[model samples]
Target: MSTVAPRFRSHAEDILDALRENPDREALVHGHRRVTAGEFHDLVHRTAWAMQGQGIERGQTVTLLSGNLPEAIAVRYAAHLIGAQVNHLYTGLSADVQAAIVHDVETRALVVDPRLADRAAAIVEAVPVKSVLALGPSATADDLLALAATRTTDPFPGQAGPDDICAIRHTGGTTGHPKGICTTYRQVREQRKAGRAGAIETDAARQLVATTIAHAAGMLADGVLESGGTVVMLDDFDPADVLTTVERERITHLWLLPPLLYQLLDHPAMGHTDTSTLRQVLYGGCQSSPARIADAVRRLGPVLVQGYGQNEGGLISVLTPADHDPDDPERLRTAGRILDGVEVEIRDEDGSALPDGEHGEICVRSAMVMQGYWKQPELTASVLRNGWLRTGDIGFRDAEGYLTVVDRLKDMIVVVGGHVYTTELEDLLNSHPDVRQCAVFGVRDEDGMERVHAAVLLAPGATTDSDELRALVRAERGAMYVPARITFPDELPLTDVGKPDKKELRRRATTPTT
Candidate 1:
């Protein structure tokens, strides 16, 4: 393990240095707006001053609800410099989900765009949102930049330490709730070093951030910045646009999800674009079929690097470029050896370390493991028994020490590259007037992709088709959690303990679709 070094400076320090090192260097690109490192730094400071003027005190929670805009990045950095913890919500989220997150975080103000002003207004009334500020011409609370100019440029609320929580990242839970995972400034710094060190080849040059600025993808944005690399942002996932950006910006390093990779490999326009500049491609999030990985390797070159991690931790196990072999037997199967600065062990139910090639829960002890589940000490204790983060994932290590994840110990379902907690889906499905009893499980589709499937027992005299049931779910829950397949079971199988027999459902799903 690399001695956890003292690279302990707030993100603010990095941003400041970037401006000094290359003021004219392109720092961010969104749509028609291309900002230089120097200009971006000034905007961050001005935005911080503006936030302070709006009565957003240091340590206060400021919620950001916007799409991929340059202002969003500026606001986040400004808040960090002033000691305010940022809570970012995807603008694509449902109103109810947004409401839940805002309430859960107890944010005093929301920094949103004009397009989402209506959504923010509806949420602020029900929640404790004292004020709302829009990024564009929609002046509601205060103009972000104008407010900053009024204050002294003499850097108020100085530098932050590593232990200070930088952002509250939310992840879906098996308990039917989404909890915020606290990521500290120090942890973020270490995670960036780990990410770059794991990379077979990465230098302070050109980088591309194609993933949404919501979770791990967004975290990598900061990593690239800290490494003195220029970041080119994408508003959303589009293969054509991604290729253009890579070619136009001379992007060398990039991260992509499996679905996006599939599109990029299959996109007709990709052949015309100049992607020869790409040196490294970090891909992760969900399972990728061997065929997909092989296709990507053939089309995108051997620059593909796959990783396995959760929102709670950074890169856990990464299959670097060195591990990618066209002829190797284990090429497509392993998540790669345990990363440097991280320790891994497969343990049985009794917490005893299991032998090699034996399936068990994967436990990791590292600088990247989260402190604990926010405010849930009992649950935290269960997962953090000793100094390890007991990841609720079923996997085993081979003789070569390459870890392969088999299944989730918990019943969490990852469908189409996104996590869909079964409990959350069940709760939404059960809320329907027609649903008397329902159980959700993940089943494989014709394409061998995992899709959300549900077993529904309707109420007496209640009638509904698969489409109607799906529509009800869409209304009650987000689209991501809706069941793609509905089975009208006479009765759901039950365990001896009376819980829904999900294991039985999995068995039934494997039977011929007929």
Candidate 2:
């Protein structure tokens, strides 16, 4: 094994340093399997050596298609050690979409889970990557685990610089094809530092990672490992299973989306589960219903922390546990104060900054912000203006500096007399007892004027009158804010990342039926 002291500059290097410091500490816990920090470090090094032997080079892209497995984690770090850009494909995405992303990134190799062998095969058929390495046994590809076992567990001599592209994360792509948000090693390290500084630290935080580690949950796992804590991974999220794991593992932190959080709240196990060990329950990815958040605060204690960010802007703001006030209902509606080291401004269409309480595009400039979209220089230039990212989100900041995101700029409905925000109406509708989930969007009427339209998912075994919902919206917002049509769908179409697909909803609204 190579014994040269590891240089600690990038986030990946820092993680290696943490592993070296706590060699015997448990780094990961998945089901009955456990890997110590030392073991994980060795695995990563071996994987990196194997990848190098396979001709993977610096600045090349390696696409990972796997769930929350130890091998997946090791491969990601190995790529980082070898200066390869890691692009994680969402497991739930269609094979066609996955192939498109792979081709777009021009991935040199694909590291896939054994379970997703068929999907990987299909993707490879479409994209034709240079190498296909499976986590375990595979009929058509080399076994990454077996290859690592035969290789020397020596850290790769190569290391990525601060400005080198470390990752290419795919955005939700709610409107169209997913865009790859390019992030560098320096930005990732800065983001990690900011997250650690802003977090409420606990000794040896036992983090329950029930979501995909490919995204923000993976970042949270890094934070846990950095703090000498154990990461308990779940292949898939089952609300009851999550509750059981929390109690069994004594989980201290959890990162979930609003929908998953809601399921956890509604789970019967939630009532019996011992979640007192939880310090922070971070949620984001979509606008959360205030009612659901308030309920979470009441049931889950004051542990709910909301993160408002995008693929382009990494965690621009966070609503801390202290900010989840039940008494201050309006404050709960805010996305929380701007994150440390992040600058946020609500700007008008003319590129001028708007005053407090005036709604406009939420612009951000931060170290955590992505370098730009990969292979889309023109699109990147359009959004990135003089170091500020034009976040297409429409929101306003209160005098106290708390941000209230209304809706996406494109999702805003302009009526003849006034304007309507989709989230504003959706939030009110979600508060209804019978409504399980809802989405609001605008469709052009006969006169070419935008009219509000809604789709709702009712609670199981529950029924609701559309007129009642309309009256509630009219009373809470105004008569003009009421939806022109309300359709009760079996379930709202969800994007690959699990957010409600408003673009699809708009298509359904406009399409003619027999």
The local lDDT score (0 to 100) that residue 261 gets in candidate 2 is 85
> Per-residue alpha-carbon lDDT of model 1 for 1-514, expressed as tens digits?
7988865568666756656577787777777777887777777777887787778876678899877677888788888887778888866555777888898877877998676788887777677687688886664555565566566555445456677777887763223466777777777767776776776344675767666676555666666665567777776667888888888988888877664675677668888888888888887775454545665677778788988887676778889777777556356667887788888889988889999999789898888777666667887788886678888888889998788876565666776657776645665565565765577788777788788889987766787778988887788766887787899987666432123567678789788775
- By TM-score, the best candidate is 2
Residue clash pairs of candidate 2: none
- Which residue pairs clash in candidate 1? 50-148, 162-186
lDDT per residue (tens digit) for residues 333-353 in model 2: 899988778899999989899
**Per-model TM-score on C-alpha atoms:** 0.77, 0.94
Show model 2 residue runs off by greater than 4 Å: 1-8, 200-203, 444-449, 507-514
- Model 1, residue 491: C-alpha shift (Å): 30
